[model samples]
Target: MERELPKQVFIDGCEQISMEFEPIGFRFAKSGPHASRRAGDWAFKISFQSNYLNVGGEYVELVVHASVYSKAIKEWDERSAWPASASDWVAGGQLGNLRTPHHWRTWNIVNPHTRQAEIANIVANIQTTVLPLFERFDVPRKLAEQVACSQVPGFMFPENAVRFVLWQLGPEAAENCLSYWVARLPSPDAFRSERDVPTLPDRLALGSDTNNLARVARAMKIGLSL
Candidate 1:
């Protein structure tokens, strides 16, 4: 029997996993190694990662990444002149990272003999771990709240969190979110000096300094006294 190329093996594994998720509204991308489901303006995606071992390897190690995106967040991102695409996800991390006792998780696909177990494991993780998190924030408002309150590292930054809340909720909620972030700071005077924070190009700077936050609020046409 001809040995399967690593890419083919990975692709086949992805296909199997996608099929498992299809009943839950996920559609596997025909051209990429990801599957996604759209819920209203939000999109949840599960993508496969693998370090393609040299050409003739029989085994591949795969990591699963899950992400969530929304039209509101994408629009906010575009205002910064950041390139926004259909896949402009605002929050997510590796599937394992979201689980308790967090640690990286990978599946090793050796061949047809071992592929079923690996695929089953990946599907189980998505169903039990990833989907519940995605379902918790099925709408833009819920997701914005999660980001603003927790500021999950791989999920989002405080700066973007404020913007997302502003878009999904309103300036009032945004201000409250900003205040929450400010209260978390070790020093109330953390944002006192504009000079302490270097000016960064709009596209490259997503800083949470007072000056930047105020600018972001003003850019959105809201009066923020920070």
Candidate 2:
């Protein structure tokens, strides 16, 4: 029979990792004191990643109660993989009253035979993989680029994230994302008015240059017509 792993295991593993690592702090958050099916929404958030994500290569900031996790040993069953995603791990978790953005991540580790081993695996992943990746790339802009190119379009860019988004999706799309409405217009100059395109702050705007996005555009054969 399958049994749900206690939430304490997650907390302990995260706590242990936080203690050993510098500049990372693990926090366990739940809505209320008691656990409920509805109130079961909780997460293990690492503060270091949240603060530094995107600056370097910080891709993720937290791990939450997975909608589903495997019940297996050390060996991962390749067949039991979750749907592939740019951000395949969970997101949309909250820290305190302030809502954190989509930065949650879950690893490919399968549930080990004993609860003790489960904790060890999680802790090791947090220390070795998650932390290193977070400090490096912050988060991959490709995930956001895919969303930008998809049918369901509505991801507002934070100021600092604009440059990275532009690098991935190209100038027109980046401007469209920053704009009130996303338009596949010819160029930044094509807009009739400021209202026609979104106004980007000086720091975020690409400023009449296609060079930054040139490589990405060339590879995808996008933005060549413009």
TM-score of each: 0.73, 0.28
Question: Against the unseen true structure, what C-alpha lDDT does each candidate score?
Answer: 0.68, 0.33
Clashes of each: 0, 11
Model 2: per-residue Cα lDDT over 1-226, one tens digit each: 5543334333344554445543443333333211111112222234312222212121223242211111221112123221111222222122221212344454321243454554465566545544443332233455446444432211222222233344445566654434422243345344333222223221213433332233223332334443
Q: How does candidate 2 score on lDDT?
A: 0.33
Error of 1 at 143 (Å): 4.1
Residue-level lDDT of model 1, residues 67-110, one tens digit each, is 87778666666564322222356667898877655689988876
Clashing pairs in 1: none
